[model samples]
Target chain A: MKVITIVLQIGFLYVFYITGSLLQRLFHLPIPGSIIGLFLLFIVLLLKVFPATWIETGSAFLLDYLSLLFVPATTGVMNYFDLFAGHTIWLFIITMISTLIVMIFSGHTSRLLARYREKRREGTECQQSLSESSL
Target chain B: MSTVLIGIVFISLTVFIYLFMTRLYHRFYIPFLIPALTSTVAVVFLLIIMEVSYDTYMIGGQWIDALLGPAIVALAYPLYNQRHLLLKNLYPILGGVVVGSLTGIFSGLLLAQSLGFNEKLLFSLLPKSVTTPVAMQIADGVGGLPALSVLFVMTAGFTGVVVGPYILYWFRLDSPLAKGMAFGSASHAIGTAKAIEYGDYTTSVSSVAMTLSAIACSVFGSLVVLVFYA
Candidate 1:
C-alpha cells in the first residue's frame, strides 16, 4: 500500500508535468506548466473525482518539501554577485528599506480593516444599548 | 566511465547538504530556505572559484532542480484537501491575490521609477516581488534577465519571511486562514511555508491560496505584463 500510495502520488505529478507542456503548446500561456496541472486537480476535486485520502497524502508530501524545489533558483542567485557589487550599498539599501515598507503596509492595511470592522461592530452594540435604555 | 562514480558521490553530497541544512534550520530557528540557499551558494561559489563550470555544478544541482515540476503538482493536493474552507473564503482569496500581486508589482515598479532607475532595470524590478519561478518567467518573457528575476525572487522570499507576519498581525488578521492565504498569494511557496507555521488553519488556507495564485498568475500576471508591452 505504501508503494502504491507513492506511485499514485508520483503519477499525479506526471499529470502536472504533461499539463505544463500542454498549456505551453496550446495557449502559449506565460504560466508554467505545473500550475496548469494544479488547476486541473482543483477542478477535478471540486467535482469530487477522488477521495480525501488521495488528496491529503499527496498534498502534504509536496507542500512539506516545496522549499527544496527552489534549490536551483536559490543557488542561481550567486550569478548576480556582479549586480550586487555594482550597487552594493544602493541595492542593499533599496531592497532592505523597501521590504520593510511592504511588510509594514500590508500588515497594517489588513489590521486596519479588521479594526475598522471591530469599531463598526462596537458602534452597533452602543446603538443597541441606547435603544434599550430609551425603552 | 568515472562520471557514474562522480554522480554517486555527488548525490550523497547533496543529501548531506540537505541534512546539514535541515539540522541548522532546526537548531537556530532560522528559516529553512536560508540554509538551503546559503549552502548551495557557498558550495557552488567555491566550485566556481575553483574553476568548476556551471554545468558541473548543475550536474549535481539538476538532480535537485528536477523535483520542482513534481513539487508544483503537489501544491494542488493541498488545495484539494482544503476545498471546503476555500469555498467559504474564495472571494477574499482572489481579491487578496489580485490586490496583493498588483499592489506589489505596482509599488515595486513605481518606487524604482520614482528613484530614477533606468528602463531595463525598471522592467526587471517590476516582477521582483512575485514568487521565483513566476517572477523569473515574467522577467525572461519581457526580455529581462531571468537571473535578475531569480535574485528578485530570493530577495522577496527573504523579505517575506522577515516582514510578512508582522504585517499580517499588525493588520489584526488574527484569522489564521486570512493571514496564511495573504502571505501565500503574495509571496508564493516560501511565504506559504511561513504562513503554515503561523497556525494550522492559516497554513491550510494559505497552501490553497499559494497554489491557486500560481494559476492566477499565469492568467492575470501575463495580462498585466502584456499591458506594459502594448
Candidate 2:
C-alpha cells in the first residue's frame, strides 16, 4: 500500500504534467498541468472511480513536508548578495506592491465564488430535507 | 587535519543554528512568519555587507538545501484530500490558473520591459511571481541562470507571505478553500505556508492550489518562452 501510494502520486503528477502540456499544445490556453491533474482527480472522485481512502494517506504525508521545498532556494540566496546590493530597492518595492495585488484579487474572487456555492448548496439541502420530512 | 576539523565544526554550527532557529519558529513565533524568513533576510544582508561570496555562504546553507526536493514531493496530500471538492470546482480552478498566470506573467514582463530592463534581468524577474522549484526550471528553461532564479523566488515568497494575509482579511476571504487557493495560486508554497497559518483547511486547500499553480505557471511560462523568445 505504501508503494502503491508512491506510485499513485507520481502517476497523478505526471498525468497533471501531460494534461497541462496537451492543453497548451492543443488549445494554446494558459492552463497548467497541476491544475489539470487536480481536475482529473476531482472528476475521478466525483464519479466514484477512486475512493477517498485511497489517496488520503499519501496526500497528507506530502503536505506535512512541503515547506522544506523552499529551503534550497532560500539557502541559495547566499549566492546572490551582489545581485541584491544592486537591486534591493527595486526588488523590495516591486515585490511588495505586485504580490499584494495578486493575492488580494485572487483570494477575494475565489472566496466570493465559494460563498455563492455554499449558499446554493445549503439552500438545496434544506429543501430536500424539508420535502422528505413532509412526505 | 586542521582544515578538515574546521570544516566539520562549521557544519555542526550551521546545523545547530538552523535547528535552534527552526524550533523557535515552530514554538514562540507560531503566529508570525517563521524565523526562517528573518534568517533569510539576515543572511542576504550579511552576504552583501560582509562581502562574503554567495558560494561561500552556500557551503553552510547546503545542509538546509538538501531537503527541498523531498518537500516538493510531499505536496501530494492536500491534493489528495480535496479530490472531491476539486472535482466539484474544477472549471473554476482551471479558470483561476489561466487568468492568474497570464495576468501575472504579462503584467510582470511588460512592466520590466517598459522599465527598460535588459533580457538577462527580464529572464530572472519573469519567474519571480511563482514558487521556487517551478520558477527555477522556468528561469533555466528560458536563458536565465538557476542562481538568479533562487534569488527571485525568495523575493517572491517573502513578498507573498507579507502581503497575502492583509489582502485576505481586507477582502474578507473567510473560506479556507479560497484562502488556500489564492495563496497557492499567487505565491506557490510560501504563500500556502502562510495560508496554513490561518487553519488546517486553508493550509490544505492553499497547498493544492500552490502545486497546481506551479504546474500551471511552468507550462504557461515555457510556452511563452517558446512562442516569443525562441
Highest-scoring model, TM-score: 1
Best by lDDT: 1
Task: State the lDDT of candidate 1 residue by residue for B1-230, as single tens digits.
Answer: 37666566555666677668767776876543455465575667666777765566666677767767767666666566666766765555555555555566666666766777765665666565556667777776665667766676667666666565566566665676557656665566677666655655576666565655555554554576678644
Q: Chain A TM-score for model 1, please?
A: 0.69
Instruction: Give lDDT tens digits, candidate 1, residues A1-135.
Output: 876786687677777678776877698776667766667776777788876577566566656666665665576655557888754335444554454454444433444554566688899999999999999
Name the lDDT value of residue A50 in candidate 1: 76
- Candidate 2 per-residue lDDT, tens place, B1-230, comes to 46455445435545554456567777765434465475555555655687766566556556455444333433444555556666676655665666666666666667667677777766766676676656766787777776676676676677677656667677776677667767777777677766666767676677666666676677777788778767
Q: What is the TM-score of chain B alone in each candidate?
A: 0.81, 0.78
lDDT, residue B61, model 1: 70
* Each model's backbone clash number: 5, 8
